[model samples]
Structures are given as structure tokens and as C-alpha cells.
Target: MSLQVQIMDEIKTAMRAKDTVALEALRAIKSEMLLAATASGSKEELTADDEVKLLQRLVKTRKESARIFTEQNRPDLAEPELAQVAVIEKFLPAQLSEEEVEAVVAKIIAETGASGIASMGKVMGLASAQLGGTAEGKTISAIVKKLLV
Candidate 1:
């Protein structure tokens, strides 16, 4: 099922169950999707890649907010942001582990014969394309740096 359809179903379930946290998260996802679709000046369905990117962005945003709230000693606020993150993340593809990401980065570096940080750009582009949504960009970049250095 498309992510949007799954989200709609989940929204219904959340409403029925009176799960406010999940309902809020699901609504945010729907709103972001709508904004993204219309941002191009025409209504169009998001590609799978685009959908994944959107979901990742949402998750990242919540996580960052939670981090800030925690740093400010406000667990009361952070908890809900984290809860929302969990709800949003259900729609994302399974993420790769750091070790797996490192292995993939090593393979890419070897394949491209890229050495040193100068070639970091080359390795990163290929690795990001190969990893797609499975690995976060920051993780890929860190692994590429470690391997290249």
C-alpha cells in the first residue's frame, strides 16, 4: 500500500482509539505530503523516493526538536515529539546499521578508487545513490570520511 493510504488508515485507527499522539503525527505527515505535492505548482503524486525523503525530514525535525527540549530540561515537551517521531517512522523503510553502512561505504570507495578527502565528494555521491533511503546521509558521510581518511 502507498504510504499515504497506510497513513490514512492509521489515522482512522488512531481516532477510533483516541490516540492523540499518533493522530497528531499522522496529520502532520498528511499535511507535509500535501504541501510537498503542491509546492511544484501542480498537484502530483510523490515518487517513492520523494515520499521517503519527506518522511525522513519529518522524523529528523521531531528528533531535533526533542533534542532541544531535552537539552532545555523539558522532558514534558520532548516526550511528545519523540512519540510523534515513532509514529512517523513507521512509514519509513528499515534503516541500515552503522556497520552495514560502513561496509557499503568501503565497497564504494574501493569501486571508485577514491582515496583521501579530496575524493570524498565522489564517494559520497555514489554511496548516497546506492544506499538510497536505507541509510541516513549523516551516517553515510561519516563512514565515507572515516574510510577516506
Candidate 2:
């Protein structure tokens, strides 16, 4: 099923269950997807890859906000952001563990003969493409730097 259809189904469930956190998160996802679809000169529908990227962006934004709130000693503010993150993340692909990401980075580095920080960009490009939404860019970059250096 399309992500839109899935989100709608989840929205209905959340409303029925009175899960405000999930209902809010799902609405945010729907809003973002609608904006993407209707953006001027954009295609009418997003591809699977586009949808994943959008969802990741939403999760990342909420996480960052929660971190900032925590740093400022505001658990009350941070808690909801984190709860929304949990809700949003249900739509993401299962993330690869750091160890799994490291192993993949190691293999990619070996395959490309990428040595030293000089080849970091090349390795990063390949690793990001290979891992896709399974790993975050920061995690992949850290692993690439560790393997290459």
C-alpha cells in the first residue's frame, strides 16, 4: 500500500484509541506528504524513496528539538518531541545497528580501495547509496571516517 493510505489507516486507529501523540505525528506526516505532492512543479506523487526521506527528515527534526529541550532542562517540552519521534519512527525502515553499518562501511571501503580521509567522499557516496534509509548519514559518516583513517 502507498504510504499515504497506510498513514490514513494509522490515523483512524490513533483517533479511535485516543492516542494524541500518534495522532499528531501521523498528521504531521500527512501534512508533509501533502506539501511535497503539491509543491509547485513537483510530481503529483512521491516515490517510495522520497517518502522515506521525508519521514526521516521529520524524525530527525523532532529528535533534534528534543535534544535541545533536554539541554535546556525542559523535560516537559522534550518528552512530547521524543514521544512523537517514537510515533514517526514506526513508519521508517528498521535502522541498521552501528555494528552492521560499520561492517558494511568496511566492505565498501575495501571494495572501492578507499584509504585515508582523502577517499572519504567517494566512500561516503557509495555507502549512503548502498545503505539508503537503513542508516543515518551521521552514523555512516562516522563509520566511514573510522574505517578510512
Candidate 3:
């Protein structure tokens, strides 16, 4: 089934189970998908890669919000954001561990023949395409920088 259909099923399940966090997160996903579908000049449906990218963006936003909340010493505010992150993550493919990401980055750097920071952009572009959704951009960038330098 498509991601949208899966999400809709989960939304109903969450509602039946009285899972407030999951229900809230699923609704947000549904809203975003609808907006994307109806956006001006947009296609009728998102491709699989687009869906993954959308989910990744949602997770990143939640993580950033959680980080800010924690920095302000507000655990209460951070908790819900983190909880939503957890719920949203269930739909995403399993993430690459740091070690896994580093391995992939190393391979891409080798394949691209990238040397020094000067070739960082080339390496990053290739790595991001190869490792998208499985790894965060920040992690990939840091690994590329460390390897290049």
C-alpha cells in the first residue's frame, strides 16, 4: 500500500487505541501529504523518494524543536516533540548508524575521487543521493568533512 494509505490506517488504529501522541503525529502527516498533493503545480501524488524526504523533514523539525526546548531547560515542552519524533520515525526506513553512515561516506568519497575540503561538495552531493533517508545530512556532512580533512 501507499504511504498515505498506511498512515490513514494507522491513524484509525491510534484513535481506537487512544494513543494521543500517535494520533496527533499521524494527523500531522496526513495534513502535510494533503498539502503536498494539492500544492500549486504539484503532481497528484508523491513518489516514494518524496515521501521519505517529507518524513525526514518532519523528523528533523521535531528534533530541532526538542533540542531548543532542552536548551531552554523545558523538559515538558521537549517531551511531546520527542514523542512525535518517535511516532513519525516508525514510518521511515531504519536509520543508518553513525558507523554505517561513515562507511557509506567513505565509499562515496572513494568512488568520487574526492580529495580535501575542496571536493567536499562533490562528495556530499553523491553521498546524499546514495544515502538519502537512511542517514541525516548533518551526519553525512560531518563524516565527509572528517574524511576529506
Residue-wise C-alpha lDDT for candidate 2, range 1-149, written one tens digit per residue: 88899999999999999999999999999999999999999997899999999999999999999999999999999999999999989899999999999999999988988889999999999999999999999999999998888
Q: Please, what's the RMSD in Å of model 3?
A: 1.0
lDDT of 1 by residue, 91-122 (tens): 89999999999999998888889999999999
Global lDDT of model 3: 0.92
If ranked by lDDT, best first, what sequence of candidates would result? Answer: 2, 1, 3
Kindly report which residue pairs in candidate 1 clash with one another. none
TM-score of 3: 0.96
RMSD in angstroms between candidate 2 and the native structure over all alpha carbons: 0.8
**lDDT pick, better of 2 and 3:** 2
If both were scored by TM-score, which would come out higher, candidate 2 or candidate 3? 2
lDDT of each: 0.93, 0.95, 0.92
| Residue lDDT tens for model 3, 43-142 | 9789888899899999999999999999999999999999999999999999999999999989988887889999999999998999978998899999
Regions of model 1 farther than 4 Å from truth = none
Candidate 1 clash figure, as a count: 0
In candidate 1, position 82 carries an lDDT of 100
Q: Poorest 10 consecutive residues of model 1 by lDDT? A: 37-46
